[model samples]
Target: MERGIIKIENGEIIIPDTPVWMTVGEMSDLFMVSAYGIRKALRQIFRSGIMDEHDAVRPFPYAEGCYAEAYNMEAVVAVTFRINAAACRRFRELMLRRFMEKSLDFYICIPAADCNHRTGYDAAQVWQERHKLS
Candidate 1:
């Protein structure tokens, strides 16, 4: 990246952006694992509203792109406050829409990082929260 934002020296995409969300295939490629494993990890993310499904493609939730996004902690927490843990599960619901469904209506928005639109997430806090050590 000529923008001095991020580097991809070894195929490991070092993201300069935050709150990055990706599909099982992309996550598996990043993690160097199988898509099935990615799906396993995503089960929790989907339940947390940190990820969502996009029915536009089919009923398989493959369109996870249609709803997932980087959101401020306040926004997330605010939306979270309105939902219960059981409701977060993707088995029967899209956690994001149960919370911030309005974001789904947005057709155009700024990229999480520069030099490319899909390089990163919009909220560093979301990524930190997801990967943060407990």
Candidate 2:
């Protein structure tokens, strides 16, 4: 079976199309990490309550009369945060920047006083506080 296309630009990996599921081997290749490492990270992710296996993983028919465990995009992102690799570092940076941008955009849409009153703090600061990993 053909794995979906993956692109890396400016050290960040991107899946251009939706509904792209990747196996452990494929994700290991994409992130430049060992397959064992990927599996370990996945287990840690599940253990940490970051994501549920049933929601993140599914069975994919990779070949005739054969199936492999596949991971969804949310699982990919969660693992990216858990693993230690060059690609994972870059991906985390990209995700953090995007999250901050979105928080700032949301802040701009609301009055500063209203935002403070609604969240009891600055939106960006709240986001940073909530997303601090380790």
Candidate 3:
């Protein structure tokens, strides 16, 4: 969603302790960021050195041991559609391999479901296909 900064109103209801927490489905709809983006951001933060045992710079926090960040529509619209889905597929491994590599101060946070990535895959099938294929 939002790439650089996230602002919250005072007393905002925090669903979870992370930067932003919405259902994986809700995020896919509201911001046009697919579940893959959410999943990627989660994995990215873990790998990006942006997180700690308590909080992550990416904003994802978990009640249990998992965490995921929230993003804004504008921030997620920058990924090249032709590669957003593929980008997710590509970076997923990097996330795991580079887990704790270093925290990224900012990311384009592109949406694979956006126009840029329109050429990459069918929008409706963002959730249908698994991202493991290379």
- Please state every model's RMSD to the true fold in angstroms: 20.3, 9.1, 20.4
Ranking by TM-score: 2, 1, 3
How does candidate 1 score on lDDT?
Answer: 0.38
- On lDDT, the candidate that comes out on top is 2
- Provide the global lDDT of candidate 3 against the true structure: 0.43
Give the lowest summed-lDDT range of ten residues in model 1.
Answer: 1-10
lDDT of 2 by residue, 5-54 (tens): 35577765576655767889988888899999999999998998978888
Candidate with best TM-score: 2
**How well does each candidate superpose onto the true structure, as a TM-score?**
0.27, 0.65, 0.26
The sequence of per-residue lDDT tens digits that candidate 3 reaches over residues 11-96 is: 23113333343444454543345778665655555465544423433454546877655443322322222224544334343434
lDDT of each: 0.38, 0.77, 0.43
| Candidate 2 vs 3: which has more lDDT | 2
* Superposed model 1: Cα runs more than 4 Å off: 1-8, 11-13, 16-19, 45-134
Q: Which residue ranges in model 2 land beyond 4 Å of their true spot?
A: 1-5, 9-12, 98-134
